[model samples]
Target: MGQSTTPVLDRVGFAMLSIIMISVLVTASSVFGTSSNPKGVSIPLQERGSPLAKDGVIIPEALARLAYWDAAKQHAKINNSGPPNNSSSLFRRHSAPLESKLDDILWVGEIEIGKPRQRFRVDFDTGSSDTWVFSSTCVAPICSSKNKYIASESSTSTLQVGEFKKDYFDGTEVSGPIYADTITVAGLSAEGQWFSPIDQVNNMEDYGRDGLMGLSFMSISQLKAPTFIGTLLSQKKISKHIFSMRLSSGSGSELFIGGINPSKYRGELTYVPLESQTMWIVKGSASANGRNGFNGNMVIDSGTWV
Candidate 1:
């Protein structure tokens, strides 16, 4: 797989300029033939850091917006769908910053788990559907540098013997046992949420964060468990089935679950219906200015680099 760096935003025009670098997620209805290509995998890679713009031509703000739609188109092509439909009326919104790091390609956020609430830094990935973390039981070198989740300490933690494994396009792999615990994000909490505690890792350096919190649907999860967001929605923790993010060039970024923050973007919020329940697939057409544009489906993947 080839690696490229670019900034992208969500369909609703969130101003977050994600600096993505690594492999792309290939969708089922690939423009290219299907042969089990690594790019065809649904999982998104944790990207390396890059500046919002190269040279001096593209302004960061303008490029960020354009990249957002471009990323959307990429998702459409991957999923083999159409362009994103405009969403201007859904207005209930809530927001939280993408915190804990600066000048990084991937956005990191803090989430609380267990009874006493052990905090962990997580990469909120929209491409894949599984939330895996480093466990205290892990003796791997990569696990040593980050906070590990201790299942025994949580009064609500439950152990399960099911195997969990996820492979990225870059050849990074994580595998371990599954556990159900309480997870809280942005003041929203879910009880008995299923997640994996990684005991083995390969190409751990490809990911800069401690763990991955996939925001995609449960259909893609190896554990076949509802994701944190899905759990929240099912339990009525969040009212809407939508989330928004704003990644900035500063010390932190913002993530809004259940709605959009009107103060973040200026224009009308474009709405796109999800083509598939597995990932956030949107309908939209894409092209370079004056060039012939192609129409297809794209995934709004926060885990993928542009």
Candidate 2:
């Protein structure tokens, strides 16, 4: 006779069913879902174990969210992955990274910058190369709302070079100029994190957010600024070949720098060759008897899902 099913196993069954179904639904190329939009976030991965595990799958949204938050709370940083704490050098300094702190996790949260201090996060996007918020001049809330706007009014150096009257995938066609601003994330600061000075649009409303931070792993600066990962890799940080990332359900998640406990990842991880400024990418090999693969350029970006 077949064994009886536990409530836990039953729940796991449901979650797997949901994810597979959603993947199928979005896989169609012609009717492909617009991932560029809000509802387009990828289906959450299994919370704890392999999606195929009988007792390991997690399908519920609540469960997935909880897992991500749990991961972030347990966050740590990348410091020379090979050894004991070595802060004596430029790259070896290790501190409990802000990635662990609540502020770094922004499913939706506030970010204050500049003298006037602009605040908003509703349309936060990780795919874009720029970071912007609304202002008084902006019809968005980052501007006139009693809330706050980055007081560009106080900065000593400012650039109004990048202006956009165009709409982004988020559906907000905001008017603003890209300028240089000192930015702070969970108390960690970037002296020249690119920012914008523009007012919020009046009609725009997100589930409600303070602002967006670009986690896409691209360099927007002419000088080629460091990426979220490269920033950690500087000088003496980390020695691990890879780190694990768990984007939990809620706004928080962890980028386990050195490594994620192996118990988490399920499928095989493909390591594309790393290109210095090109980021993470590897060349695909040719068929057994065929010619070598394309000698073309392939830049590796961790933010890329495909």
Q: What is the C-alpha lDDT of each candidate?
A: 0.57, 0.32
Q: What is the lDDT of residue 22 in candidate 2?
A: 18
Once model 1 is optimally superposed onto the true structure by TM-score, how far is the C-alpha of residue 115 displaced, in angstroms? 1.0
lDDT for model 2, please.
0.32
What's the TM-score of every candidate structure?
0.68, 0.42
Give me the overall lDDT of model 1. Answer: 0.57
Q: Write the per-residue lDDT of candidate 1 for residues 11-90, one digit (tens) a residue.
A: 22212222122212211111110111111111112233433334424346534544554544454446545445632112
Per-residue lDDT of model 2, residues 1-306, tens digit only: 121122321111000101111111122010110111111112121111111112333436434433342222112111102222322121110111112121112233335565444444332233343465555455433344434344546463366554544333213444566655555433333444455545534323232333444443343322234433233223224332223334443322333333333333354333333222222222323333576744533322212111
Local error of candidate 1 at residue 211 (angstroms): 0.4
Give candidates' CA RMSD values in order: 13.5, 19.7
TM value for model 2: 0.42
| Ten contiguous residues with the weakest lDDT in model 2 | 28-37
